[model samples]
Target: MESNGTGGEANAPENLLGTSPGASSLRSRTESECSDKLARFVLPSMDGSPPKVLTLNEVGDVLKNIQNMELVHEIAINPEFKFEPYEPPENSLERRIKDIMHKAFWDVLRGQLNENPPCYDHAIQLLAEIKDCFPQIISQNNTRALQHINEILDIDVIKQQAEEGVLDFRAYANFVIHLMAKSCAPARDELVRQLTEIEDVVDTFKNILETMALMKLDMVNYLLDFARNDIMANSVEYEKKKFKEYLEYYKFGFPATENWLKNSCIHDANNKPCSPEQTISNAYMELMDWDESKEFPEVLSIDKERILKLGQRAKRLCTCAAVISICSGVPVISQRTENRVALAKQIDIILQGTTNEKELLDSIENVWLQVKTVINEYLQKEDQPVIDANTEDMLKSQIMQTGNKDSPVRTLMWKRFQTYFRLAMRSRAGLPPPPPGYADFKDELEAYCTALKRVIAYNHSVFGEYFMKVLTQQRVTSTDTTTSAAAAAASATESVEPVSSSAAAVTEEKSVNSQ
Candidate 1:
């Protein structure tokens, strides 16, 4: 959450904005945008002002995270998610000014009351302002509380009491505090107690107002949470309906999905006919090894971040497995505690530091030192120098070979994982076990499997029909083209001498078939 100098916190009061992406902007709009006091104010701005500035990142985070969320569903799923209170940085100019202004305001009121007969002017305004806060805290449905509050703090009635010399300003503050205790969240019970600790009328009123600001936020969050819970409870189906409508309006116009699936089909080392099941699995794999410049298929936007992270983690696993294979070749260590395995894992970390291939290639030059450092650290722990000068050269030479795309260890491990993934995509009752040499990466592979299954299952639920139609259409086109080409070749192989106009007709027929 980015904090500006204005003392605002990002993603404030979830209910202030609509739960869906199409909903207009958030925290709360000013009176210019909304007319009703309650409608205009769900949660007060960070400075208790009319409008709050939500940063770009904050807005993006809110929209992206809630883009597919059914607010009702989110609340149902986790009603306990806390909405943090906004507080300006203590050293910020806004906080300093607020503190100064609040103190000065309280001081004037205190000074007025300390005068010859106690002016009561500022006190009356403060009471009126405090009176307005009742609607902010208590629900409109709680008419009993609202009616009682209105009668007790009515400015007209208070003025009469002041003229009659019977108005108790301190009593009104105490009454507001008592009402606040009943209105606040269970979490704020301690704040009500602290307000009681301040005996000075001015000090008590000052803290009471500040505490009310906080309690208002708590009430807003609580209300927001309640609304969101009901929203989330039914959000899943609502989201599906919205997504279907979105697709239908565009005619499920997913050229990106088509391109992604087609590209995955062509990824064989040898140009062979790709199966549809394998194509889907390969497409998922492509997302993992996806090029950064290319946009992800829009249909998978919900799982975009998850797939990317999973891909990176999966890559790290494969690379580590390969490194383990490479490490065994170097004559660098004692056979006691699996030092080669430790070295491999550490080396994979360096190699997978970033997604940038060039960066990793550049860093490959220093991998030897890293490898040495890791081994030396382990060796020192065991009271031995596992890598000496000769061993360092051998380990560095073998380790650096991993930078080559064709390195035997790298190729072997990658191919094994790919085959395992392809097999994992199968739906048949009995299937082949994962390829050998994956035990070292079993945990990562399992995690990848779980994440991939979730994406595949949900995506298929939403898009299975479209994918099937597209794939079936593509298959039919390929078959017709292949059959036409084969028939053309077969006819061309036969002798067809020109035997007059009849031969001309035959030749024309052949030409049509060939074309």
Candidate 2:
């Protein structure tokens, strides 16, 4: 048995699909949720800020990529998607899996090929599977490659070659690689090279299978890119149909949406009724104040993860901006924009994936060093005197306190950011300017707001009719129940008159006896 070398895949994370920074998993979003309506995503903030549970539409730009995707199976139009080098999983479970997959299967095939008289049973099946991949990856117009595949990988000829002592596995592999090299896109040239250069027969074939998997992805993505224009053109109607099917499902409905809208609706200073659009927009904006204990409104649930991730992104920026605000409070770095940005980026890198105070404090020890370094760079660039030990100690003392939520500067900036969100949400006409002090997070706020507003406008345009239909039905049912209860109460009040009449007669008799 030959040893096949390997590596693992890197997780390609996004807030969600599409160019909008509201991240979502295109694949994951297609799943039906607990409400079993549309798929929902959970956006856990990297910093200690609150987790946002949102829906796929809330992720924004997904529908723009969500059309005629193999009739809703395996196509995505992600502008940000990139082809990355393949690496196999590196964990203990994956090691066991790798052993079973490669050691047990490929080794058995190799062992069978090298056995007395050469068994063609397993080899033929393996070749058959490999044969299937060619048609999947290549075009029908490439008649030369198709004809070559038939000649080389023909099961009858391969079986006959095995019957004689003349089977050459390397010849089949070389021939396939020759065609793969020709067919593969430029991005996959390296993969094709890796497939060609592997010396061991088993390694060569394993690399072949791996490279083919990547090639198929490359082809699909290329197809997706080519098809993206068509996808965007037709996405709205396709998404509407799919969402209608979800709504039509007997068990699935937007039970939470009616209440979410009803609760989030507000009156102006004059107590005038808000327009329906205002009502819906206000409801979506209220998601920023989400409570973890409750479920997201069903309408928003599908994009729950994307919306939350966008919120998380916004929160992460705010958190980082606050830290920079604190670090730069030393006057030298505070006055300079570059120093704050550089220092904040370094701190964010250090603080990545931290979800709470304890985890945050663990990394604070290194932040002081980042702060000092950034300050020194700024001073050197500007030809200012470098900081003394007293200044360094003062900066370190200030920086370390950021691990706490109440670090005064951090809290102050956070409050300003919160104020900004509320002010933005209050009303477009009467929207107040953002609270000052957290200006560094302005870009984050803008990006999140843009994605949210876009998602809201697009989602409402597509689904508002359906939303109103459900809301109307729910309201009618509620009003009917209320009317029935009022009728029952009125009947009980009519029956109570007899008891009052009897009490009145008893009081008259008592009054006559006393006279």
Backbone clash numbers for all candidates listed: 9, 20
Cα error, candidate 2, residue 289 (Å): 4.4
- In model 1, where do residues sit more than 4 Å from their true spots? 1-239, 266-275, 324-355, 358-370, 380-383, 400-408, 420-445, 480-515
lDDT of 2 by residue, 1-515 (tens): 00111111111112111112342333244544433236565554434555555464443322233323223322222334445655567777867776677778887877886788777687678788889999868987888879889988999998888888688888888988998998898988887987877888777888888888888888777777777768756766676776654332212234456667776657689864466566666676666546556656655544576667665555455657666766656666677776666666677787777654577677777777777777888788879888898877876777677666678766776677666665665557744554554455555557666566555655675578876675566557767987999999999889998998999999999999999
TM-score of 1: 0.55
Clashes of 1: 9
**lDDT for each residue of candidate 1 in 1-515, tens digit (9 for 90 to 100):** 23312224333323322122232343455555433332322212333345434444444444344344433333443436556777779899999998899888888998988887667888999988888987988888999999999988999988888777777988988898899988888887898878888889898988888888887787788788667746654555665665554432123245666777776675356755688876776676676566768857766665566678767666666666666665555444435336765665566667667564555556666766776676677668868767677877876776676666467776887788777776776645533454555555566576676567556655665566667677778888988998999998777655343345677898899999999
TM-score against truth, every candidate:
0.55, 0.64
Off by over 4 Å in 2: 1-78, 81-98, 251-253, 269-272, 323-331, 356-454, 469-515
**Weakest lDDT window of 10 consecutive positions for candidate 1:** 12-21
